[model samples]
Target: MEERPGRFLGVDPGAVRVGLALSDDDARVALPFDTVKREKNDKAAARQVRSVLEAAEVPCAALAGVVVGLPLRLDGSEGEAARRVRRFAEALELTLGVPLHFVDERLSTVAVERTLRTLNVPRAEQRRVVDQAAAALLLQAFLDARGQETWPEADSDEAVAEGPSPGDEPAPAGPRGRERRAGARPRRKRR
Candidate 1:
């Protein structure tokens, strides 16, 4: 654990489950955190997510912001799903008091599924971890994009005006090279 300057929470909001990921303090790596089982009430789901965030034990002040996966259609249009994600993001912002940033997550779940299959994860087991895996993928994209100078400041007008730039090319469909297992043990911190 080298001293990370900051961290960001990543969200993959779904109708039944909300996936969560946390970036390294340096914002270089994204790790699966947990999944929030949603109730019929959106507010209740938001509360569940907030509780998880609090229970992670990291200081809220160390978080840079929240990055939410926006599930846009292939044509880059916001469908009903995208609208729901936006609503969820708004509610989460209200609950957590953190700025929200959206990242295009067109095939995040598919990518996660592919990685699981490659790792020989059983179909039944995949269902349990898919959401969190997708969240890690989504957050990894945001973290990688940030390295490339794509992410704007959380409070900047350009962030509002331009939205999250996915850059000119789409992210790879699946995790590159090695597969990251769900709930993998955290790496030991170096002295």
Candidate 2:
């Protein structure tokens, strides 16, 4: 292999929009790039990704691999959406001649939504920004789990520079919190 920066491309594939994210020039951090609309003809979406790769000056031979978001059910089961994503990834691998990987995207959308909400983004405007944000979340999650590079922990700089996103509600703190509060319900008086 040419062994360039080894930058990886992260994809959050959707029926209507395919979000694209890229690792840094040094392949150190993955950041959201763009969201390409998937019309009746998916060729349009592929073209958009090609443009992004070209604009970024991504070395065709240097791509370490492409990471795709795998949507899993609450019990970690793959559904139709997940299958579609996998199919898309496979097509990319064959077409682009690059290795492909998958990362669990169980709650990536939720995470992105929480981020937007924390930043005080407006609800009506969220549709325009959610895909890219989801892409960033998906890529960052993959990088973190792989332990492949030293991605910056600070999300502010990357996200802010890209642009503010409109998000959704934050997820509950954690399972422990949910459990702790599970029994704290209103007490009923004896009738």
Judging by TM-score against the true structure, name the best candidate.
Answer: 1
Runs off by more than 4 Å, candidate 2: 1-5, 41-44, 148-191
Residue 137, candidate 2: C-alpha displacement in angstroms: 1.3
Candidate 2 vs. true structure, TM-score: 0.68
Q: After superposition, how far is residue 191 of candidate 1 from its true place, in Å?
A: 66
In model 2, the clashing pairs are 113-168
RMSD of each: 16.9, 13.0
In TM-score terms, candidate 1 sits at 0.73
Clashing pairs in 1: 1-189
lDDT for position 179 in model 1 = 43
lDDT string, candidate 2, 45-105, tens digits: 5556766777777755678888888999989999887877776776677656778878888
Which stretch of 10 consecutive residues in model 2 shows the poorest summed lDDT? 174-183
